[model samples]
Target chain A: MTAAVETAQTTTIHGDRVSLLRVLGPAHVWALGVGIVLVGEFTGWNFAADKGGALAALIVCWIVGLLYTSVAMIDSEVTSTVAAAGGQYAQAKHIVGPLMAFNVALFLVFAYTMLEVSDAILLGDTIVAKAGVEGLTHNSFIAATIVVLAWLNYRGVLMTLNVNFVITAIAYVSIVVLFFSVSPWTQGAVLKLNELVTPGNALPYGWIGVIAAFQFGIWYYLGIEGTTQAAEEVRSPARSLPYGTMAGMITLLIAAAMTWYVCASLMPWEYLGITYYPLWDAGKLTGSPLLENLLFIATLLAALASANGCINDAARAWFSLGRDRYLPSWFSAVHPRYRTPYRSILFLLPIALAFAFIADLNQAITFSILSGVLQYTFMSINIMMFRKKWPLGSIRRGYTHPFHPLPAIVLFCLCVVTFFAIFLGFGSQLIAMVAFYFLISLWFHFYRYRFVRRGDQFTMPWPKPQGY
Target chain B: MWMALSYACWGISIVLALWMLYDWFKVDTTYSEDMLTSSREGELEAVSEKHRI
Candidate 1:
């Protein structure tokens, strides 16, 4: 039962080495990324409409889209080389130092965990609202959703994400179907384009409001970068990571456009901004019970799909922390039979459930958005260090991002703008999140640094970093 | 009826959670630390050694 320290030479162990199953391909990767994000199109993104107007929300969507495009390109390049479970945290360890890597891991864990919480809560509330049964609360349904998804993740990633693919695809098609069903293309279509141009509907709160709207614009593509979390599990990190991530990004952009058009065209900006279920409301406007029922089912499916992917990702990031001894090594163990991170998956379940039970939806979404934006800020720095330390031709890269510094620069600038936008709305929460991470950084520096094997942290067999 | 269904949902979830926790501790005891913390990244490298990409 002695723990073997990793070394330059082999330290023989008594039992067979266990690893996560490398069965996932590009489709699972697409499902993993999109499944976590498609739910936003169904419900969350319209809050942007509330802040500014429908036009401002649409503007912010394209701007934030640019930010995530940079994220995808930079992530695809680094993950192709690193190919580990923790995604950006793994990249941070190799590119930056251990302290930054620790924080990035926390960011990934909290961001996904909080998103999972909100998704679960949304599922509970949605069911309760629709069921029309007095005395029924969301507590049981919330518990059931988190437990069932965690169980699915515990069984294996392949089936979990395969199910995500089907459900996510269906949720996405629900939007497209609503779009075609409304027939905005025809002259006598049902869409009210006049509502879009109404006084104050274009920019109700002015330029500052447009800036504030950028925060909610993130909902459109919040967890798309999570595709990188599957790096270790994917069969071909080189081909699959970029293909799945970029394809998922394209799907999101198209979905976001259609969602905004359909929702904004059907309702006034004031109401669209405040509505709980924008897509479902848009379906109701068509006066079709069939589309309403279809959207209702789609909303539930989207939430389930999102919560399922979050469990997959949050567990992986936490598992990576355990594997690296950043947290307790006990959390690192992979199930021999299922080849999944059973301990990490179990560890996050209660934490998510507790947060789902108490956390306000807006607060949960805000924290998730802040954590995600912070990770993108790290990506800018990580990519710059990656190119400088390794340079080109230093090692084989599976996918190389075009226009290197440009993407990094754009990603950083957009992250700053998004942070400012978030500050305008949730200034206290932004400051509070920073203070929390800062305290954790201090704890890691003083208490946790001793446990980490610094040499073992850099796992890749590349030449020595240049000018290091 | 709604109340009964709610309780049933909660009961099923709690049982599932308990089973996972039980399995978690069992796996910890059954496996060695070396086996659990083994470098899967190294194994991945070995598998793709012929083609580094």
Candidate 2:
């Protein structure tokens, strides 16, 4: 009823924990969100063209873009309000229960790690293809990249932020160059939208193809919510969280549109679909080897930047779960000097490498999107629960969703659609996702449930701060 | 029918993006300076306490 009574939830963790240094500002947070996702603009989204052709892929892109917009809006409201290092996991703990929190943590880690693994593999494949390196194994390259990223992450948060900002800037600038160089406007070609619908072309696979395209289309915005994992390191979580997320989403949306339009217009959908690096291929269409080489470097940088952010997010989620005793307490250990989550980052490196070796790019993308949608569904539900549990009048809030329940409800329905897309399009991967959920639930019942000492609690500090 | 649906999806997406942009600038960014700095120390202390546990 009262603000004090509403904020009375237990804010303590029982096990050993280490604080993350708050060195990141709003710009760094934006870089983390966009950098984790910018690679999709360069490579992955073209896969949708194979399934649905240009027109259908464009349609799917619009739908998926809207879905992520809803996700970004709702996540901005919830993350700013909760403001914890755990990100979605912490939000789940406060609004749902520990069981759901455990599940969300696992899903978040799975999604980010899978993205990282995929990027490592893709970067290796790109090097081999672009550099004409003979007999170089993708496995070796992926292993080496993961090790390098892990070391850089272990150094310190500031170094990681600085490196991410530089790589993210290069990736985005490359996209802008691609847009100008290959765009229909620059080439003096009108977009023949009708040409995409020629008999056996547009929806070659029909509505099923459109559904299939959703998975790849989602890659454009998959990692934006990851910015919230930086809550602990952000100077002003309440203000920075929303600003970074929404701004990142807007930038990605524009980038996605430019990418899809330019690539689809410049090249045949069939050729674009098969290429490992679509932006590079699009640059090739301009008959400039120089632009192609530049795009090659950009694509590699995008993958590296994305892998960097993925490691940051997945490590934080692991740290949160470990701190709460969901996993072993050893994972909660922070570097003595760097103050980084060294243990968790090291723990994940081998698993990520192994996943990279076995999983193909398409499988990795679908798996990541599927796991992300699962986590987001719970996040949407948690938003509604938070509002009902602590109404606007009952709590000191910095930012709240303007439409409140509408955005959450929309996000839930969109997530359901995405689930069906992944399920029907990639049936085998869906089974694996189910198995993962089962195993996580088993662990929760056998071990984690016992260690859950706290109830539904919102222990974040409230009231009084402005302009941070 | 598919063409019609595609157009509709594009239209709705455009509207949603515009609405999100408006909400970001109008509602979320309109917080007072008091709300931003009110519990700065308390919030940081709470975060530290959570970690120290």
Candidate 3:
């Protein structure tokens, strides 16, 4: 193969060719994964309580946690082997085809962008609530937060990771504090399993309520997989990716359990069901203004941490696609001194700001979950495909999943169920997701027939040349 | 029926969480070392081939 083809196949940053610096370590990876989903511990999952009561919501969270665990296991193996910045997108390209790859990239970008916008809005509202500033508009705060996060991201990957680490640590410690301070176990309150099932009970809505609550329950573990996007930038991804993802998953599971248990037990399920911010309400249940204030700060920190990680993940996804010529080449440009994807971060900043101002948080979250479920489905399918294409002993294996394709298959099935549940729960958002996919498909087909058929330079980088 | 399902889900999640923790601590790091070594060798070989060309 010619040098040009080799370069094109191996590396994606062309024209003003630049590469990403491997600055992230295992601890950073853990923080990235945990930070992206830590906000779930503060809010969002309470909607599940509304749907299915405390016990039912806890059950749904448990089920979703298992689904994410299976996904993490499979993804660990795939990321260890491929170790690309594009992450699931790159894996899809190699295992499936370019069409699936493009679709996955679009889904990732949509999911992370929506998450970023939603978290920014949540952060602004949290700050206003903490300050007791009535009638103060949060839109300005949202815009300011977006700009600051974008600037921090552009400064360098290390700075962004360091900030995320501190914010994530605070967010996690707050959850532990909340659990110990208010939970029935620590509060000397009577444990009542029987009351959980009494007529007009905690689960007054019934089994259907459990199904209705699945989407909200999913909040606890939604964006953890985005950590793998840093695979190329992490030191020894083969080890760190698995270690980081698994550790983060375990932490999230514990946090989810503690949050659900504490919030559910401290207050009546009926009351917890209606509150938008359950953690804040849990603090209120303590009848202590100081604890409420601390929980308020924790809520803001959680939102900021989640938003920071979303920016990091979204920018890398955009950078990878742009570098690979899936998107415009300008997005691939790395800052000369900082070695960061400044262009892509700037490009996404305005969009996030606009969405934060105008979009409804509930709808944005539903859409984000929709996109995330689709991405997980694709990742699971790609894992199976990779196993078939390159069997266990065929490639220089890093960390092989213990059960081969079982975990992948299970994850795929769970994702399909979750997709249908989300569609049923949020019909309008499902329609929007379908329309978005349709538009993406049209562009992909047009690009393939128009540019690829004509042998243009802008083509999908797949069926990678030998020895790449 | 909902009660049974909730209990089952909780059981499964606890088991899964424990298994993940075990796997996280027990999984070997030697594989990553081998991978890094082999990747460096591959890069060197590629450079040598480029020079010959």
Candidate 4:
């Protein structure tokens, strides 16, 4: 993607953080806490619900989550290193040059935006489908949620999280209730170990299906960095971030796994895969419309709450970029009262809204998966570089992945493979990412012509501290 | 009940995080020098020198 390479933009020490109300500490962040990520109930259930792959899938989730933990841990550390307002893009831009950083910033926003759109589209579809309602435009619902999110965020960051809080609470209640209904009754449905471990224990569909099938599970862990993105605004970065992502992941693991198990035990795999509303399907198997609606609401809340992470996190990324003059000054403009970037809001909202009018659930999912891989790769690299350059002192200096280099190496390689997996999974459509990169290039071209050459050199300078 | 309680615990935590930010971190685009310390004018040049943006 193209970034408006700042030639030598004037420097400003006017970095402002959204009030603490916008920052979260470990006190609030939970592991795998997000329900919307588990929304791909169909895909997750596909493996664990049937095909006798429950045990295998569970092991796979543990493995993948474990692998990702290092990256998540490292991210918490490096991101916390500078309490300054600059986020990943800032860190990358400073480490690399402005141009490279700009490209990364563009890529990060593009990926995050696509992910949000995908979640919105799916949740909308899940809701309508579960209702047995026809003519439901899934993408529209997704798009609409983005609009609402944009609207709420524009009012300020607190509004966005407030919305998330309400939405998440409702969704959590519904999910827990669904669990209650499905758990005790559905327990014991997992395949017998002996049935599989012996000779012809249904040789899995080779490693390809196994890896590709595991992609959805990987996504459940992706947004754990939500706290990292919001680090600067946080009061006590050292403690909040290190634990927040860990908490988020832990929350997701148990919640998602249990949800999968509950659904898997209650119904058949094909049933889970076929319905857009996997949770609702679980309820229906129990023959409860009330329960179905309950799940439907949960799905919606999960998706919306997940979007909260996007609205605050993604915009902040762009806001960070704007602050660096990597993109444009417009994005850096914060509302007088709300303290949030009003500029990026204008940009993000319209595109999300347009996407609502077009595109489908699958497209959003594809975009998210592809972009997510890109962000993960860059973030892992950034952490490794930071650790190599700056020796750690206090946890406040930066949060390091427990094992350090090993996890970083593994995550970096895994991401590279995931990138390849995207092309294989999406085929011709994979070109969309390439196209996105080029489009960003074009944007950079225009941005440079108008800004950089016009004496708006945005090259970030050497590190400067406050206390002298 | 444990699951429900856990979910509730998670919910309260998020709300608390939101509260921590006073909802203002939502507006910060990057961790800039201006953010860490309130407006201490002469520090801009020093802060800039100390931290690489």
Candidate 5:
């Protein structure tokens, strides 16, 4: 109280402050993170099985689970203190320099936007498959999804995430329903245990196979860290951010395990790896129209929930960047009526629509995953720098992750292995993305930095760094 | 039949997008930059009892 009051007296009142609505609780944060990721269980994760085998995919699932647990801890610590909309991007700015923040903001934008695009495409495809109609263009469904979800986001954060919670809850229930329908408890029931030990099924591609599976392993929990993006909007960031994030991580780990078990036992690795909707396929294997219908509806809801979450996160990152004058200051404006980042939300709609229209689902997902991997890699460094600059007791943290540097080191090493896995599969695309970011960094340094408010960028009122 | 559904979806999307664009322009024309960019975070922070270092 004394320090804050003193700082307030010294600091200038820089006009009125335009901010996001801080109405969210831990539940909204959980919805935001889990909603963006639950869709992955339906579609993209099976690609890991395709790369390696069912056993390899399961191993990668747990490995990536460990990777994301570290992420949840590190992010919860940093975001609880930072309390900003851009999540890791905001953390980078306060802890590292502005250049790093700019790149991190881009990573958030692209990662979520690409994921949004993939979700929209899957939504459209699910509808198409359900209808089984000839000459049904997916463009309309994709466009409608982007438009509708962007509208939800532009309206308000509370409504957007509240809707996400409902749909995401239903989608999760669908997974549980599928798990129960198989009767895994009964001896010699629906599950074929041979799927695990069959020749070439356990480790189809050997060591390289497990490494390659790492690329798709992320699908099990891609956007759980996104819970922090709601930091600026949450009612109690310190408590809510960590609680929501850790809960979401736990939920995802359980969901991933159950999804893997049910799907792997129901189908052979050869078929499960290549299938688009492993859960839905498993539903079909039950020979029950009711289960199949339920799974299909569940997939649709998950896609919608994920797309909605992606739009919300990407727009917040863009809005934070705009607020800092990294881009046009005009984009920072909040809707007076709704208090939402309306302009930023509108700005990203076309970008997501463009990708949804042109890019294949696998390509869009690969790009999203790579973008996320890059962000996590940055996070490992960001947290270490944060501690060195302002060790413990220098500032108040909402929650402190245990085992300090261990999580950071583990996150870094896992990120390196994941990158190697991606390189084995997407070497050319990885190179292209690197080149693209390099070009953009040059542009930001030479051109955009002039527009940024350097002195005003540091919004937190904590004391200066040790050396500074 | 599905084509009709798709076309209807496209039509709804276009209409919704146009409305948003109109609202965007309306909001821009209606409000000043100062008012639009004004935030409540600083005010709340000042009055709050939580003592952040």
Candidate 6:
């Protein structure tokens, strides 16, 4: 443990007192991950790789799932140690100074916000398309969704969580039905899967799809940690945060891989790129009227379920900012009636409404991915820092992290690689985001040191930076 | 073990979702302050001020 860096005595705002039942068990956390990523079909993830004849990409997806064991196992210990409300922001502030931690939170705010905004756009597009408008030709679809969902969230978290519990349930039901339907038909598919992994069918050796699949897998698994971010609302953070992250990842990895294999093996590779919503297409092909409606309703439910959870999550960054005095104090105030961050929730609606009205879904995904990658990278580093500072004896544990430096180094490198990979994956928007953040951060601290003086007075050995 | 159980639970959840069409027939507007024990401006402000770094 670092001699000087003792853990801070901080009990941050974890909204309202609730029953132990309110805290999601790991299963719900995992379900939340599956809900976010396993949309209708992840045609978006591997269509090109599948067509480039990357049969091996499927196995590579499994390989990446294996790596989640190492990644999530470590997260279990770290989250247990610091199960605070701000997720990575709390962890990062504890490890690095607030300045660097602030950067992480700032980027993370964009990551989750963009993700919610994009999902809202997708929701809008789906509803609008049903009405018979040529999609890309008009700006109507994404716009309508943002307006509706934004209003839904502005109303409250109970509304958000209650609806979330319902929709996420239905969405998951459809996914299971899809796998089972494929199972009845493709009885021998998984056993005879060697043919699918042959050289000709797989992506070329060392193909980028392997990495892209990993990126998608990791990003798709991004929000499990988010379950901890809402730790305050839960009855117990110490128990739920640790178990939720571990359990959730394990569930998502198995569920996603199994569902992917069943669908991918049964459906022709040629059909993937043709449909944005592949499960429904798969259902139509199955000729199961019951199944198709179930899958359609299931996917719609997922998008709906996820929208509420994600929107509630997005407001947290603003709420944290408000709590920390980065924004108005009102932003941090919890609703007296709702016990949720009303100002921050209200803060989120206008921005989401604006993006929903103005931007397309893919653009929102690109921004979401870029910002999210930064938070993930920071989180991996935060674990490493905690290892240096905390006495291992102080943390009560079932699973202990292997000796430091090695795991931390490996995690840090993977995080760095993923960060760069995301930048490349979303090309120019990433560059634009970097520029945008730098400008905003610069402007934020510009007039500082001259008049305003703020920072961690207790921790400083020397005088603090101008205005923190 | 965790993975196997996760799969089983997911399958079970599918059955649960189908019930949504029947169960969620009329929407219920959820209140935001599901956990607010009572209006505690004093406690809320104390908690709020404590948060300022």
What tens-digit string does per-residue lDDT give for candidate 3 at B11-51? 55455435433432332221221211111101211222222
Query: How high is the lDDT of residue A19 in model 1?
Result: 78
- DockQ each: 0.49, 0.02, 0.02, 0.06, 0.43, 0.05
Interface RMSD of 5: 6.7
Query: What are the per-residue Cα lDDT tens digits for candidate 6 across A1-468?
Result: 221112111112333332112334544554444445444243344443442333534654555454444456666676554444455665565567556656766776776677777666555455444445342322333433443454455544445555565666677666676777666454463323444445565565355655554445453354554564555444444566567667666666765666556555545545543456666666666677888777666656666656566666777666655555555444655543234565566567668767766777768766776676666566567766665565465444434667655655665666665555555466677678889878766755664222312452112121222233
Q: How far is candidate 6 from the true structure (C-alpha RMSD, Å)?
A: 11.2
> What lDDT tens digits, residue by residue, belong to model 5 across residues B1-53?
78888999899899989989998987777666766665523244334525555
Per model, the share of native interface contacts recovered reads 0.54, 0.02, 0.00, 0.05, 0.53, 0.05
Candidate number 4, chain A TM-score: 0.81
Counting only residues 3 or more apart in sequence or on different chains, how many pairs clash (N, Cα, C under 3 Å) in candidate 6? 11
The CA lDDT at A247 in model 6 is 67
Q: Which ten residues in a row have the lowest lDDT in candidate 4 chain B?
A: B36-45
lDDT of 3 by residue, A196-247 (tens): 4355776778887888788788898989998898886786787899999999
Which runs in model 3 stand beyond 4 Å of their true positions?
Answer: A1-17, A183-200, A448-468, B1-53
Which residue pairs does candidate 1 place in steric collision?
A: none
Off by over 4 Å in 6: A1-43, A47-56, A66-71, A129-159, A184-198, A204-206, A212-219, A395-410, A444-468, B1-53
- Please provide TM-scores, in order, for all candidate models, with all chains considered together: 0.95, 0.83, 0.83, 0.75, 0.95, 0.74
Mark the regions of model 1 whose C-alpha exceeds 4 Å error after superposition.
A1-15, B1-5, B46-53
lDDT of 1 by residue, B1-53 (tens): 76787899899999998888787776667666667667455457645654333
Q: Write the per-residue lDDT of candidate 5 for residues A1-468, one digit (tens) a residue.
A: 355334323422333444677899999999999999999899888999889988888999999999999999999999888887888988999899999999999999999999999999999998898788888878999999999999889888999999999999999999998888888776357888574547656888887999999999999999998898888788888899999999999999999999998888888888888988899898888899999999998999999999999999999899888888899877788886677889899999999998998899989998999999999999999999999999988988889999989999999999999999999999999999989899999999999999887888887767788888
Give, for candidate 2 chain B, the lowest lDDT window spanning 10 residues: B33-42
Model 5 steric clash pairs: A17-B38, A17-B39, A18-B38, A18-B39
